[model samples]
Target chain A: MRTDLLRRVEDRLRSLLAAERDLWSGVHEGAVVPIDALAELIASGGKRIRPAFCVTGYLAAGGDPDDPGIVSAGAALEMLHLSALVHDDVLDDSGTRRGVPTVHTKYTQLHGSRGWQGESRRYGEGVALLVGDLALVYSGELMAEAPRSVVPEWNRLRSEVMIGQYMDVHAAAEFSVDPRTSRLIARIKSGRYTIHRPLVVGASAAGRGDLAPAFEEYGEAVGEAFQLRDDLLDAFGDSADTGKPTGLDFTQHKMTPLLGWAMQRDEHIQALITEPGHTPDEVRRRLLETGVPDDVERHIGGLVERGCKAIADAPVDEVWRTELADMARRVAYRTS
Target chain B: MRTDLLRRVEDRLRSLLAAERDLWSGVHEGAVVPIDALAELIASGGKRIRPAFCVTGYLAAGGDPDDPGIVSAGAALEMLHLSALVHDDVLDDSGTRRGVPTVHTKYTQLHGSRGWQGESRRYGEGVALLVGDLALVYSGELMAEAPRSVVPEWNRLRSEVMIGQYMDVHAAAEFSVDPRTSRLIARIKSGRYTIHRPLVVGASAAGRGDLAPAFEEYGEAVGEAFQLRDDLLDAFGDSADTGKPTGLDFTQHKMTPLLGWAMQRDEHIQALITEPGHTPDEVRRRLLETGVPDDVERHIGGLVERGCKAIADAPVDEVWRTELADMARRVAYRTS
Candidate 1:
């Protein structure tokens, strides 16, 4: 029954995106080509995980399965998430996303083909940026037009997630970031946006605001566990399974959970990392040689075990526990 | 009275931005450096035209000056405009904005000083993007949290402005863009955002919805005039006064009104423009030599003269006519 509900939500989200894309039909003659290309690329490759969580959480809280309002709101969250990803790729100079050429890359290719000097990169970044802005605008419109009961929570979720994104970016750039600061960044950047806020939005839409706190706690634990698990995968998983380049964190200079843990390791491993210009591949290999992968994998194992225990221990309805268990089975245990 | 009202709006805007800036405190090692830097850069530079329009339109519609709700809504619009500008500069690869180094450039310089190659640009773009997102989020939050009476109109204005931005970006890229398409883009991108919607919000706040249509029409005409005048300045204005390198449009290949008009000029001018490898300066000089400048200047002169006549002929209120008159004086007779 829960699977059926998630499927329906996915369908609704696809429909909403399709409707919005149609609005760009009359965009200026030269601009429509790239805009349409980017939008289609985004729509084609989305995992729609955020929207699905929003919908499932709503349903788990007894939301009406047929509620068009809830569906539209959930879709808006998905679109916003997609917008964030599109802009992020441009900022990161990422060439590929979700096993496809990124919007910027595609647009850049067109620009190059047209023989317009320096235009390829400009077109890519410009169009992607505009599309992201469009997503944000539409997200608000969807929330505002939602059934009145759901508007308050939807707006709150949107604002909080944006604030959290700001905190995440700000925190990442600091050198001597404290543990508490890091944790706060973690909570706002990944914990709240990925789980807590989505859960609350869903619950509120379902008129189950009373369950919000419990869901928040559940989301926190699960979210932390998810990040930890992802950190482990970054080091240990096969390239195909992760669909990401191996040693990506080391290359990008990203300080993930595994790296943070390794930074706290006994002196030898720490010295190798502190070495300037050390390739991410070299760091990953060194960590592997030091038997650090096993240690980190054990840590991830512990986080998942603990996260599940906490979800199980929560004083919530059996329905929520069951749904969470299912989620853990799908998310924490899966290879992909 | 109008000047006093503008002062009130400006003060309110500063306070709101300050409060919003405070929200980032302690999130980044007890120093909100990046967010503060970006926000300060944005806050200090903008003209606050949107907020002025909101305030004046409200007053024209008999709005109460002391209503905190209108003030908040007006401030929110200004922030939204700021957010758009920050992102737009990044998108445009503009090095300086309002006579200051752009956020991306500042970050790049800082990164270079720190010997952080390439990372600084990424860091700057990432932080600036997040900052823009934050402003956008807060803009909605401000309106959403406004007293319920003005909420609907605020929502409408936000939607219109955002949709208009999308349309504007789309229109700017098109090749076969007709005059009507150009006019529509001007209306949505500049007219509605800069004037019409602000007026609607003001009128709605003042319980004078009847004035919205006139405001919309007036805004459309004036906004087109504004964009057309901008094109003229780009083509012919002094570099010192405009703060842009003269002939930048030809270099950037921007489809401006001057170039658009020149495209339809006699065969002599068309031949010069199609010359291969001509430097932007050479192109500008050649076009001017072909008497394109006289034609463009005459065209602009005609626009200003006709624009004033149209505004005078319209049945708008006295305040609106006075505002249009001021704009005409600025556009028609200003040396700058």
Candidate 2:
């Protein structure tokens, strides 16, 4: 059921975009550019984690496969994430995403090479901004196809993520290190947006909102684990595997919960992050020396355990419960 | 009726932001920053053109005021316009909006002055990007409160505007002057999004989809006139009344329908816009010498007449018909 739903979501995304491309291509040749950007990003692919959780939650709650709302809902989640990625890449000046030149990077070069009218950076970033807006609008269009019950959660989820992202940017700029702030960012951006809300949105789609409490608990724990692992991957993971540059968090001086925890223990980490001319490798080697990586690893394990335990007695089908546990482990331990 | 509805829309917008601010401030002090930006923009107002058109559309269609959905739809249109304005300011690099420093300008200074960790430009632009995103999300939230029947038109209106803006940006970059492309962009961005779709959404909220045809015709004609006046305002109007720097279109090399028409008759205007070191005064003087501004004034009068005539025989109440005619004149001929 999960695999089928995932396929359906994938199909919906491709065909919807293809249809948009077809329609806009006739309007003006340039109208298709942003739609094409969206299509390329989708094809380049990420983990599809949000959609997976959404569909899995729907199936685990025994939703009817024929309802069709879940498919659109899942697709909407992925599209929303795409918008965030496009805009976030601009914020981070991330040059590449999913192994492809990011929208801004590609367009910036296009403008620079062509000697376009305005500032090349502005033109490129502006194209990317509009493309992201298109994606956000498209996400809403898809979500409108879902059941009305999803509205409240969907609204809350989107606003929470944006606000959390604002705070994340603010924290990074300030080079802040507060566990309370970091935890709040993680809870809103990762715990809820990525994991908890998707699960509840799915279950609610299936008319089983009673599972929200358990889903929320499990989602928060496992989502934090997911985010910690993300920070680890950003710090030390292979660029080849991740398809994005490593140690961007360090370079951007992002106060990741992982980094915040490390900063609490090692004074030098702050200097390494905030001070220029210090390489990511310097920060990575320093991070290793701080012994905080091991602590993070241990915390991730505990969070995964707590997450699994949260759903242990839930009334989900036993098979699905076991699958959820496996999903937790995969999310926590996956390298990329 | 329109006045009361507009007031309700204004109240809805203020209370909604206040509530969001209250909720986010509890999470983190900095989290309320974006919400505050939105509130400030809304407070330092423009004409509230979109909301006025929306509520006017609903009232003209003989929709009942107590229904409440029209108010939210009106507010949604305004919120969506705010999102566009925020992003458009970034795209245009306009330092000021509504006679105050723009979000990017203000944040960029903060980042520069405080010596933020990342590039100040990136940090400032990023904050503005996220704040714009928050407005987009909030627009969706408000639209959700409206009747579901408004969704299709709402969706179409948003995608049209974004894509139209994309094409506009591309046209400016390419410095293209095709009349067809300019008119198409104008129709999509202004005719539909600014006037027609909001009205349709309003009427649809009241279950008056039947009024769409008249609204469409009136909107397209008046919207074009409205856009030409916008170009004129940018080229020649006072910033004190408009609350924004004039001649941004000239500097950005925007291929407005007004410019496209003028260029067809005059050969030298293109160089005036495309080349650097030419002041807005030069462009304005050159534009006047081309005798195009006079043609534009004549064209705007004709379009406004066309707009009012299109709805003259519609089923709308006689009083409302006169009000809408007055709105078209106000939109097309106002100093700002």
Q: Considering every candidate listed, which one attains the maximal DockQ?
A: 2
- Over the full model, what C-alpha lDDT does candidate 2 score relative to the true structure? 0.91
**Candidate 1: where are CA atoms >4 Å away?**
A1-17, A27-42, A60-67, A147-182, A206-210, A242-246, A266-281, A289-316, B1-5, B62-64, B146-187, B204-212, B238-247, B266-317, B324-336
Single out the weakest 10-residue window by summed lDDT for candidate 2 chain A. Answer: A272-281
Docking class of 1: acceptable
Candidate 1, chain A: TM-score? 0.84
Q: Best candidate per TM-score, number?
A: 2
| Candidate 1 C-alpha lDDT tens digits along B208-307 | 7777766766666556556666666666677677544555555544555556556656444433444466665656675676676676556556655655
Alpha-carbon runs more than 4 Å astray in model 2: none
The digit string of per-residue lDDT tens for model 1 on A183-218 reads: 565566566677667777777777878867767776
